[model samples]
Target chain A: MPGVLVIAEVADGKVLPVAFELLGAARALSAEGAGPVSALVPGQAHAQELIARGADVVYVAPESLAGQMYDAWLPAVDAALQQSGADIVLLGQTASLGRDLGPALAFAHRTAIAPEVTALKLENGRLRVTRPCYGGNARAEHTFAGQLQIASAKPKTFDALEPDASRTGEVKTIDAVGQSRITVLSVEKVESEGVRLEDADVVVAGGRGLGDPSAFAMLEELAKLLRGAVGASRAACDLGWYPPSSQVGLTGKTVSPTLYIAVAISGASQHMAGMSGSKNIVAINKDPEANMVKAAKYAVIDDYRKVLPAFIEEVRKLKAQG
Target chain B: MNIIVCVKQIPDPETPASSFRVDEAAKKVVPAQGIPPVVNPYDPQATEAALRLKEAAGGGKVTVISLGPESARDAIKHALAMGADEGILLNDPGFEGIDNFQTAVALAKAIEKVGQYDLILMGRAAADWDMGVVPMGVATLLGIPCVSIAKAIERVDGKVRVTRVLDDGFQTVEAPLPAVVSVSNEFGEPRYPQLRQIMLAAKKTVQVWNAADLGLSADQLGEANRWLKLEALYVPKVESKVEIIEADSPEEKARILAQKLRADKLI
Candidate 1:
């Protein structure tokens, strides 16, 4: 059987969170007798972490791959796959590199492509992948009978397999078509405060109930004290109280945090789809009967003006003691 | 300045979801015909932005490219109706199931094949899959700086100033000629295509390039080069029932709600 290739994205000289997630999934898939799970980390980084996370073989290219330039990375990935003899390749869904690079790699490799896949399995030797369609309203299953299969794994939906401290793997460099046709003239990284919504372990989102954007300060403070991120319902975003980036719904980022706090959110199905997977949830709204309250592990019915300050105090207290 | 706007044809998502189905054996989405396809919402915004830039520049050429089945002509026509000077459609069976990466490569190839454009414009994300990855991939393939989620773009002599919507607020950046930008819906509503222009768009030639014509090998077109896999697909199940708490009096309702809030530690 052809071995599986796991493409790990390295950004700003660091292996991204999705790399570990892909490793875990690749390991599980390989364990089921699909093929060997070899990781392709196309940057100047140590591959030991990949090996520890269950990558049987790791490919590393030091000099030309460190930057998150898609132009440079595409050829690097193509070179790695060609050398690895991987018939099945996997990637993280929508990582900084994965989003742009994943599809290009698919086209380059001429393989069937599936993205936002939430689950994977092998049935009778065929590779099976599943992803949401119709804006999370339905799910579709795909099985590639061809020799090669490629898919992008959904983030925050799977556990990152634990690394074996003692596990060791080999790292080799592969020659690629060098000299990128495109060049990154310059790069500017945006500065952000508090936890990034993508990286947050906890997220507190508000809706129109917060009244205005200024009131979002309370949610921001609460998020800061919790070491989490703040989000808003589509309503809040539409009301111009928050930027679209902070909006949580079908059109925004799909977040699955350890704890999700919903305040004054009406719990539209689309918004729920984005965050329904949060391990624990709490909701606060004036409506004693709100859809979000039913989805919460804990529910509160009160004015945000009264409850927000108290919650902030409690979080501050917890942080202070720690 | 030559501005190229890449557009896509998609089933009108606003059509109730119930109208579609999967041809599992065929491994394809069965299109619900009769329902018209439109320019992916963001593409028009990008086109409008390009038009504005052109209008501001006094005059310039606006070329639109769309890749899909032959039906994709509708998308190109839509762009042409909106004042694009020319349109091209890349139609071929080999392009089916081509993921974002290949789509970008094909697009980059098309742009390169066409040759000479100062700016490439695109929507921040597509309605289908909504991965928002194409413009970046194309930029990478073309080796240009890509600014996504752009709310505005203004051309000033040698460069373009872009207002990017960041998570917290916004940031303005300037880039020299030859850059890729994915315009956001917030860029402003797109203008409607005029009647005479619509008629002219139909008669104007829509250049069709196939996988063969683009020199894209079968391997470079579809699943053979795909690098990602969907592990599984099932309807996300999240069920919640309404919570109704009736109060006898207005004051009592407020008190009850307040009590619930306190219990949850939200107040």
Candidate 2:
């Protein structure tokens, strides 16, 4: 049977959550008469968790290839792809890995790849992937005419499967050439105080409607209380209100948290494209007809300045009660 | 140093969401009326990156290359206005409707024609397709290494050192000369062209080349050689049911919202 292969991404010696998310997506796609889902990881450390997440087979590479560099991972991935004979390959659309590796692999395999895929399905035995086009103004369904189909899905687009310790799968070790032309001299990481936006369960994002850059301090306070991350719209970033790294939009970062709180944001398509995958949305804006209010699950039609302090107090009270 | 920066013309990305439409049968976006096309937002940053590197080197040439219809000359002009020395337009009827793979082939061929370039730069991705495949594809075709999503690039000891933006943080990587790098929007806003520069840019002659000029056959340049097939394109149905919280005071509303969220097990 033609199976689906997922590239399990690892960072800093731990498996990133998106790796399981890709396995979850692979399982769902294969459930409807596609094929068994298999995962390829850089090392054997996380092979068991992958099995519990519905991977029927786990291909682990040598330990030396555990870094996130594309050159290090490419050889092992190529080997797994060949050995599994999978017709479809799924990878997480990550900033560090997928963005570069997906295209390079597509060129190497002489196939096409859909990046930032939001949805996937099988029709007439062909894999059709849906991705945003025209900066999220429209969705395009793309398929491959070649033998192997490769695609990368945005993080948090799929729900991870519940892990079952009772489940088990076969684990195989794959050979890696470990050859690369580029040399990594040094890496500098800006350490943030709170949870990273993509991994945060709750995110409080501000926009130009916030009126002042200082207003982000309130959002940061709220995020601190909730143990979440703070985000900003591109407009706010363009206004020099926040660091560009914290901007969430089509041109910026794509974040899919469980609860996205939009403070004074008027849901432009570009901004919405980045966070529309949030499981729940709450908007605080004076304009009831604003795009954000319309798209939110719950909306408070009041100025964020009027709503935030009270909301923050209530959240504090609830937490205090616990 | 000689740098080749690739720019693309795209529909205005900031067009209001309400005006955006799709042609379902044709599987394409219907360009909204009254919104003039602009340089793909990130392309300016790429051009800016090239110009900065050239300026820092004290003496170098920067050439802008674009692949699109005749109207795409404006994209090249925008780069020229930003101080690029020359512009090349790969305009041909045969280039229409080509996918990213074929697009890369054409760009690689154009780079070869240009002959001497120590660096090739492009936007991280075109705002329209958001595929971000061309830079790597072109590098693969040219047998060069590629560094992507670079927010800052500099010439260090005859090699290109780039500060790349990652999900959690950033990393600095170095690649040899004659390499490809795609600049991210984090490179900061591109410089605004002065009026005099714009006039000079308009007067500069842009060299237009066809597929034959690049030694590419018509059969290898369009949808016939595309690896990906467009199955369908349409506006996704957005269904939203918003529950407006009502209360006499902000405090009451906040209390009720917190209660509702807890009840729904969302917090």
Candidate 3:
């Protein structure tokens, strides 16, 4: 049986959390002694970090694979699969690059690919993957019969293992292959003002109950003070108070952090689907019976008008003191 | 320059939870009886963009292509009413449970069946899966350059200049003729069909092609090429506590709220 190959995505020389999450899930499957967990880290020299994260072997590309993610990435993934003779491959479901490259790679290799997988298990001598459908309202299970299979794992749905500092893995530098039709003419970077949302340890989200949509500023200020990201309920998004990208729900980004502060949200079940994984939840709302309060680790009953201003001011003062 | 815009009919997002059921044995959602499926929200943007191109191409053809159950004819009719010159519905039981890759394969075959076009336009992603995979998959299958998340596109001279939204902001990419561009909502709001156009659509012929007719079979449609397997589905579990702060004085409430915020480190 071939081993499992995981495509670990690196941007700006840093491996994304999704890469680790996929590896961890692959490790879980490999723990069954099904296969070894190999990784493909495409970059000038980012393969070492992948080896540290859980890979048994790392494939590093010496060229500037950073800019041409899909071009270098696809070949690296394909090469890893060919070398590992791997029957199964795992990748992060959230990457646009992943979504773009996955099907093409699968097609070229004549392999099967399951995407946005929330769960994976071995059943009846085959790999079984579970994915959500109908906007996270239902789950579907599929079993693969092919000797080779690939899957894109959804983030926050899998746990990345703790780093094994003592473990060392083999590294191989591979020659880049394929003439990519896609070319990167130039690259531009956008500067963010606050903590990167994906890297945030804490997050605070608000909903329509905040009265004025402008009240989101208060939540952002608080997030800034706490060194976190500001998120919004779908209700706020549908109401056009926030961009669709910032909407947190089953249809939006899935986030799991140490703390989630939900302000003036009623906690619609769909919205809860995204943030329920947070380690600790705090909700501040005027209505004591709001559904969000029921889901929070701590709930405060107060008008956001009275609560938010005070909260922002206090966080500002605390940061000043620090 | 003739263009084909592929569309899908999906269960409305606002459909009540109770009205939907999961057939775990089959790994599919059973839509409630009497419920209506709507054209995907993104396809209209693609349709609108295509119509504008048709207008600029000295009245070239704009065809709507859809693959779904027979009910998809209703979806195609909606497109016809929105200025599409014609509609083709590719419906077959074989396409059932097909993932993005399979769907793209069947769609590419359907496009081959249509046989003539310069550009293929699609929505960035469909609401049903939000996969955003089909357009890219189709492009790859056809060996064409694909640009997704296109917020704006205009024909300059003989080439297409496309403005696409990336992870951070946006970029302008120029590609020659016969390219695939997946449109975003920012392309423009789709125009409402006039009464005259709706009447014309009623009389227009909507050609339906089955998988067998298109020289495809169930063996190639679903699980056969499926590289990924689904394992399980369940409602996420959530539990929380809410506190309501009540103080007699405004200043007192503010002070207490401030203290609590500081304690939580949200401030």
Candidate 4:
């Protein structure tokens, strides 16, 4: 039985939560007779943390392998894959390293990969998956032609297992490196103020229909009052009405908050792709026929300018009463 | 500094969802009837990036390349209209139904045929498939460094310096000449072509090449040579069961909606 290997990703000196999600998915496949599960980490010894999350074995590459260049990091990754004997490999996302390294590995190894898989299943030692296609308007179901498979899952699609301090796993250090062709100058991680949009339970987003940048102030106030975060449609971000950091769309962040509020949004397919997974959706728009209004679980078909202030006041009154 | 920019043409992304259709049985997107395919949105920014790099280098050739049916020439022509020096269209029946990998292989061969370039540029992603796989794929085939989602690209100390957009922030990295860089929309708005430029571009050199021209064969192209098997493609059914809150007044509606949300424990 071929094993499953997860490329554990680290950001800000800690293994990303998505890496644990990969392990969670891998452990399930392992339980289904895919053999053991391994987490491949470079630059740091995250073995104990990963094992607690679900990895059966952790392969640690030398610190040098953590260098940002995709070419410079390929060799160690290849070695880890070989040593772990994993026929199926997984990454936490399609952005960052996954999009770069996933296709590179597939091309280098002369194999195929479905890099943005959102669903996965193991059948008779083959990996079957479904991925968003045609700009989130559709999904493509794919099955590998051979046993050696590579895929990267969309973030937030899988659950991360709880840490088990008693769980034990092996840590094997790999020795290999690749030729470096790129040099990093600086990495700036912009720490957002307050709750991060992706992690926020409630999100109040505006769109171009807001008509003016000042309208975002109302949204910010509402978000603050609700102790949530502010978001925006791509149109609003592109028009500079709000920061690009707050843009919610296929090209931006994938958010699945418990509650997502859309103000003056038309709910383009791309925008829907990002926040459609929210547990509840509320649309405030003047256009009764807007796609957002139709897709929303609850909709107010009136001018957001007229509706939002009163809505905020009502929420405040409701909170005060309770 | 010679630069190669790969462009593509696809159905307009702004085509309303109401008209967006996919044939489940055919496993294909039924092109929206009224919208003719336009140049992929990102490719112009790529062409603009290349044009700017050429201007900065004082003097160099900017060649635009596209791999698709003959209609793909519009993509090359769009880049040319934006002041690119020349265009190449890689078209062949063998190119049909090719996956990203095969597209990369054909493009790599075309780039090699185009010969000697300091840098290659492409849109961060094709707006249609939303697959940004080709740049890295081509880079791997050519054994060149690839920088993704570059908001800015400049030449410094004979290396390509890229300011990249991150999920939460930005990072700057430098790679040597002959590298591949995917230009993002953040690179700034691409310049629009004037009427004269469009006419001049129409008269500029537009080379049409087939698989044979690139030393490619039917055996090495299309579905037969693909690696990933597509089992199905269909538009997901979106059933809108929205509950419209009805009230005589806007304030009343707001209060009712808020109360409803509070009742549901959403707040």
Clashes of each: 35, 0, 26, 0
Candidates in order have lDDT scores of: 0.73, 0.88, 0.74, 0.86
Per-residue lDDT of model 1, residues A189-286, tens digit only:
55557688867888989998777678888888878777789999877887788877777766677788877888888676557768877876777778
Ranking by DockQ: 2, 4, 3, 1
After superposing candidate 4 on the true structure, give the runs of residues whose Cα lies further than 4 Å from its correct spot: A31-33, A43-45
Q: Give residue A318's error in model 1 in angstroms.
A: 8.4
User: Could you give candidate 2's per-residue lDDT for residues A80-157 as a string of tens digits?
Assistant: 888887899998878778877888888888888898888889887779998988878888888897888999977777
Clashing pairs in 2: none
On residues A24-134, what C-alpha lDDT tens digit does candidate 4 reach at each position?
898888887888999888755688999999988898887656636667667877898888888998986645577677877888887778866778888777888887866
Q: Is 1 or 4 the stronger prediction by TM-score?
A: 4
| Local accuracy of candidate 1 as per-residue lDDT tens digits, B1-267 | 789999998867554445656565555556677878767878899999989998988888999999998888888888899899999998888887766667887899999998989899999888766667688677767767676677888887678778766433555666667988889877988989999999988888989988888888877767656544433334445566534444554344434544553455443
TM-score of chain B of each: 0.89, 0.96, 0.90, 0.97
Worst 10 residues of 3 chain A by lDDT: A182-191
Query: After TM-score superposition, what is the CA distance of residue B145 in candidate 4 from its true location, in Å?
Result: 0.7
lDDT by residue (tens digit), candidate 4, B1-267? 999999999888888778888887877789899789999888999999999999999999999999998998888888899999989999999988777778899999999999989999999999877768899899989988889999999999899999988777888999988999999988999999999999999999889989999999887887767778777887777899999999987788898999999999988
Expressed between 0 and 1, the share of native interface contacts present in candidate 3 is 0.45
Per-candidate DockQ versus the true complex? 0.21, 0.75, 0.45, 0.74
TM-score of 2: 0.96
For A135-224, candidate 3 gives per-residue lDDT tens digits of 656656667645677778656768888887777888877775555554444444455567765567889898988867898888887787
TM-score of every candidate: 0.74, 0.96, 0.87, 0.96
Docking band of candidate 2: medium
